[model samples]
Target: MLTSSHCAIEIVAMAALRQKQAFEGELNRIAGTRLTLEAQVNAIETANLNAETMIAMKKGAEALKGIHGNMNINKVDATMDQIREQMDISNEISDAISNPVNMGIDVDDEELKNELEELEQEQLNDRLMGAERAPIEDEDDEEAQLRQLQAEMAM
Candidate 1:
């Protein structure tokens, strides 16, 4: 009952509508893919930032550890120096105490025998009383000990 030209026109219109719908669907799919890719990129960027922050913190901790190690080594070196100084002072004191010439009388000198005997007795008395003479252990006590030893040898 339809004419051929009218039927042909209706079929063309239907085909055009189907092609338009397909194009619109394809555009929607492309837009959805773009959104998913953008979300993935943002997530990756956030992860990279977090990784960088963690690396920086680790480097800072390493620097602090290095500083602490250096400080420990310096402390050990300082303690060793102090011990060496104390040993040197002790050796000097011992050498001075053992010298016969520093004792003010030659070992073979019979002419100064009585004077030497008195000096020896005075030194013994000083050793016994020195600790009780100082009320406090102060720098003055160390100075007094050195002066007293020098005086004993001069006698």
Candidate 2:
């Protein structure tokens, strides 16, 4: 009777130990699966952050490019307007110089010309008046007188 009871107790303890080992193995497998899922979640979050950053950078670059393009167009238009204005001014100057008579410009100074003519007439009158003086004695008559004196001395 004692031997049979002892064998029965050993059999029950062995069964209980196998059940504990199987439970521990199942717990270990569940823990490993949870850790693997957590790692995948972290990796996905990092990838999402990088993607969002790249998208925002692209948007900013596009916006700046559009603004710069508009500014360049405006600058070009302003420069062209200035060039056109300069060309118009140059053409006006050329036309004004080409047709001075039509623009009421006097080519000659009439007052200055009249004054110069009056002065020339006055000088001519003065010269004519000077020419009316008595005629000068001839140098030849004086030389003949000197020669007659020298002949008288010689005699």
Candidate 3:
């Protein structure tokens, strides 16, 4: 009995070791894939940044030229003032709407609302698509058949 128990324990320990090695190998493979993906993302972001920098440089040059040329200085100032006023109004509206008291709700979560809206939209789309079926006959025939069925059912 003692020998049999020892054999059983040894078998379990070997299996456990094998499982551990397999898990470790899988973890390493996943880590490798993650690193590769990160590298690819970095490369793409670097390229995007380079392009944005070039565009910003060109825009800045044009802006400086316009400023130096004094092109409609008063018009620019008026537009800036109008923009500032609009931004202030926007901020006020945002502050009011974001407040629970203004919203008249105790637990108002914008994220939850957005998620619920998305789910509702998805459900609406599903119902629209799922309820569609081929027409059994022409519109005239269908109307006549429906009327006949309704008359019989009423009787």
Candidate 4:
């Protein structure tokens, strides 16, 4: 039979060993959990970085689109300005041609009148020659005939 004091001592030593083992197991579990948590955190951070990069790229693309749109608008405005300038020039030329006083004319002087008449005749001749040189097309009649031919072909 064992003594009570010896039994108590043996029980105390076993309890201490069990406690130490439990503590070590808990520490290992905590370490594993902490490692897993760190890995998940790193994965999330990488995903966040990727998302941010994509967003920045999207913004850059949008900015490029806006710039392209603005460039198109500017091109249109430039073309309109050119057309307006051409129209203004045409108006100025027409005005100059129509105004006899602007042609350095003294209508009261007979010699100047004769010179103006000669100049006017020359201008009329040039206009006639230009008209004769232009190709004359009866567009409406030609288009109607083309349509009729197309209809006949379809039939």
Candidate 5:
């Protein structure tokens, strides 16, 4: 009877030990699976970050390309050429106004005065003789002089 009881206790202890070992094995498997899943999640996050960086770089490159297109060297040169031409024209006009001699616009004062007096005399005679009066243009002396100067400059 003593030997039988001892065998029964040994059998129970062995079963309990096997249950503990199976539980530990199951926990180890679960832990290993969790670690693998975490590693995969980390890899996916890193890939996403790299993808975002690549997309940002592409966008920046596109923006630079647009700027380059808008600021092309040929267009810049053409615009500068137009500006230079306008500046030259402005300078020439300034020179012409400041110094008429540069544009060969010389006039003899005596000759101009004599011609003006003759025209005035002719108008006076026409008014005295009761000639068929044409419609007057109402031009002042200064305006007439300016017109005459412009005509001379045109020549």
Candidate 6:
């Protein structure tokens, strides 16, 4: 049989072990609760930030729409039209500047008319010499063209 004092001491040691286990279980439960609370707070914070971002994007889109209302498409088209008009005027000026004889300042009207007539006469001679054509009843046209070309070439 065991001694009574030894038995009492064994019982006290068992009680102490049970108390220690209870304390550890309570500490673990408290720590788990604290972690769960921190996770819930973080999740709420993320959701709130997402909602704020969505609202800010919507407001920015609305502001851009308002700004577009003030922008005019017709004004842009009108500006392009003005640019095209200026380009056409500039091209006309370039053509005028490049041709001094056509400007009427260097050559008189009579001289211009004579140069155009001479050019026509040369074209007629080219057509006659470049290709063979059937004989025409109007011999006067050929005689007049030949005389003009020969006279110009002689000079």
Root-mean-square deviation of each candidate, in angstroms? 19.7, 20.9, 35.2, 15.9, 17.6, 14.1
Residues 69-151, model 6: lDDT tens digits: 76799988998999999999999999988875744556578998999999999998988898788557766888999999999
TM-score of every candidate: 0.45, 0.44, 0.35, 0.44, 0.47, 0.49
Instruction: Give all candidates' CA lDDT scores.
Output: 0.91, 0.91, 0.91, 0.92, 0.93, 0.92
- What does the lDDT read for residue 41 in candidate 3? 100
Error of 5 at 137 (Å): 79
Cα lDDT tens digits, model 2, 25-126, are: 999999999999999999999999999999999999999998786677779899999999999999999998887474565557888799999999999888
Taking the tens digit of each residue's C-alpha lDDT, what string does model 3 give over 12-55? 99999999999999999999999999999999999999999999
Q: Once model 6 is optimally superposed onto the true structure by TM-score, how far is the C-alpha of residue 21 displaced, in angstroms? A: 1.7
Candidate 4 per-residue lDDT, tens place, 65-142, comes to 987866777798999999999999999999988877745744568888899999999998888788847657667988
Candidate maximizing lDDT: 5
* Superior by lDDT: candidate 3 or candidate 4: 4
Q: What lDDT does model 4 reach?
A: 0.92
Show where candidate 5 strays beyond 4 Å.
Answer: 77-155
Please write out the lDDT profile of model 1 over residues 43-115, one tens digit for every residue.
9999999999999999999999997866777798999999999999999999988876755644557757888
The ten-residue window of minimal lDDT in model 5 covers: 98-107
TM-score of predicted structure 3 = 0.35
| Inter-residue clash pairs, candidate 6 | none
State each candidate's clash count: 0, 0, 0, 0, 0, 0
Candidate 3 residue runs with Cα over 4 Å from true position: 57-155
- lDDT over C-alpha atoms for residue 155 of model 4: 97
Candidate 2 yields a Cα-based lDDT of 0.91
